[model samples]
Target: MEGFVQNTILITGGAGFIGSNLCEYFLGLGNKVVCLDNFSTGHQHNLDGFIENPNFKLIEGDIRNIDDCNLAVKGVDYVLHQAALGSVPRSINDPVTTNDVNVSGFLNMLVASRDEKVKRFVYAASSSTYGDSIGLPKVEDVIGKPLSPYAITKYVNELYAEIFSRTYGLETIGLRYFNVFGRRQDPKGAYAAVIPKFVMQLMKYESPVVNGDGNYSRDFTYIENVIQMNELAMKSQNEGAVNTIYNTAFGERNTLNDLIAYLKKYLSEFDSKIADVEIVYGENRIGDIPHSLASIDKAKNILGYNPKYSLQDGLKEAVSWYWDNLKEK
Candidate 1:
């Protein structure tokens, strides 16, 4: 990962979970990093660790504004476009705002990157683009009708990236992230991912709610794996790897019951009472697929991606972080 020469990298949504992590990692590699975020769903505290770093710069702005996009991309060598409104239910409740931010804002970033002549534009795509497919392990070439407004926006993003790559000769790579979880993922949101929310709940000895039967499953990727994929995308010189999408995941699936059991097992190490907490089941979520898995063979063969953590391994790390950071608060 350190083989590439130092270059300035611009990460939009740099105060969000994945964005902040990328900012820190790239800065650690001796690269100048510029963070552009609006603080809508992103928290400034996410940048607390490296806010004072000389190589790190923060610009508070929204992606919906073209000027903000242009300003963020100026003089940047690569753009890791992570700014977007991410939530299936939230999109359903308000498709207009979701589309405005995810689709329109994505276009703004693409244009800015193309105009600035960035070497590569790596972005956060979603597994929701596989919507309604029912395929066991989703591949990039195969996709179905998007199930929700959020899914539509993500699929549209892939299209826009492809067009920009073809029509304007802008290098682009889309990473379809699975359920990513780790340190600094906010657990106190209406649309928070299940792992953090459940960990926080179990920390307080409260019941963790399952939106459906505990059989529904997902491929939960860790933050470290995602960080590796982004770096590979930004630095890879392989021509075939450019202008395409890769599934960024550990390539394994676990049921909701398995997740809860693992969470309880890990958290119980810090608090024995967590093992006694029960899980509550309710109606299935409206836009959620029954199960999701990813095929990382493309990432492995092309970009040399070898994820180091499994679901259980990542949960242990995440649970410990929550215990150390959020338990006392």
Candidate 2:
């Protein structure tokens, strides 16, 4: 049954948090995996466990290089392009580099995959692409202006992907990830996501800083749900799923205050010390959307997407992983 999967699967940026999880999942299903990464933003430790897997191959290369893209795509049946410069503040600080990697690198991979005649090209899009579209439960067809460079780059990916499918006869699926978090997610770094950053701060007995009012909310999706979406996007039989973008989220929203309270409660059980830590509220970040939620009806209906983990359920699992692996360190 496992052999029915496309044997040769190429995952660009395969060592990053979500990419690494996808690599492990598809490989476990008995597919030969090729992981291409430059390690600029990804860690080597992400792929350390899979290095010895006979069916897995790692190509230490950059997506910015056309030859590297060509080399990685050779004989590959499916391409999961996940490499991108993420983070709104990082893009605000250095928009040029973000555009270079997210836009240019993305196009390079698209060109190479089309030329290689891959069966499917599924890439990571972002909820940021929704930008200033103030509407709750963001749908696919409508989008507002891109507020940040990172947003621009991601929106460009959908544009290029759509063009390739129409003009060059390629199959492309875009998954707009909303705040994905899980095991193997790096909690250290200035650019770390909210979950990891808060976990790290709580473990060190430091106050977790909440930007703006703490009432700001997000539709925080779990990493395992994203892995399911990617696999389903790459393997779906419905023609409607091709050349389309789907919001990959758990369809739930949580305010920063609610999230902080939840985190504090969970961490306190491990060390009784975190129970006393205070949360500091600061000025809101520029270019940050005040609230975000996703309408996952399209994905559920078209791709048979069923998210198994809700926020509380996923956080229970994730916080436990952090407790075991990160807290002691």
RMSD for each of the candidates: 0.8, 1.1
What range of 10 consecutive residues in model 1 has the weakest lDDT sum? 1-10
Which tens-of-lDDT digit does each residue in 1-329 have in candidate 2?
23336489999999999889989988888899999999988889899888899999999999889999999999999999998888999999999999989999999999999999999999999999999999998998889999999999999999999999999999999999999989888887888999989999999999988999899999988888999899889889886889999999999999999888888888888889898998899999888998999999999999999999888888888999899988765
Instruction: Please provide, for model 1 over 68-136, each residue's C-alpha lDDT reduced to its tens digit, 9 standing for 90 to 100.
Output: 999999899999999999999999999999999999999999999999999999999999999999878
- Candidates' lDDT values, in order? 0.94, 0.91
Model 1 misplaced stretches (Cα beyond 4 Å): none
Q: Residue 290 of candidate 2: its Cα lDDT?
A: 89
Q: lDDT at 121 for candidate 1?
A: 96
Error of 1 at 286 (Å): 0.3
Instruction: List ranges where model 2 is wrong by over 4 Å.
Output: 1-3
- Model 2, residue 275: what's the lDDT? 89
Question: Any idea how many clashes model 1 has?
Answer: 0
The lDDT leader among the candidates is 1
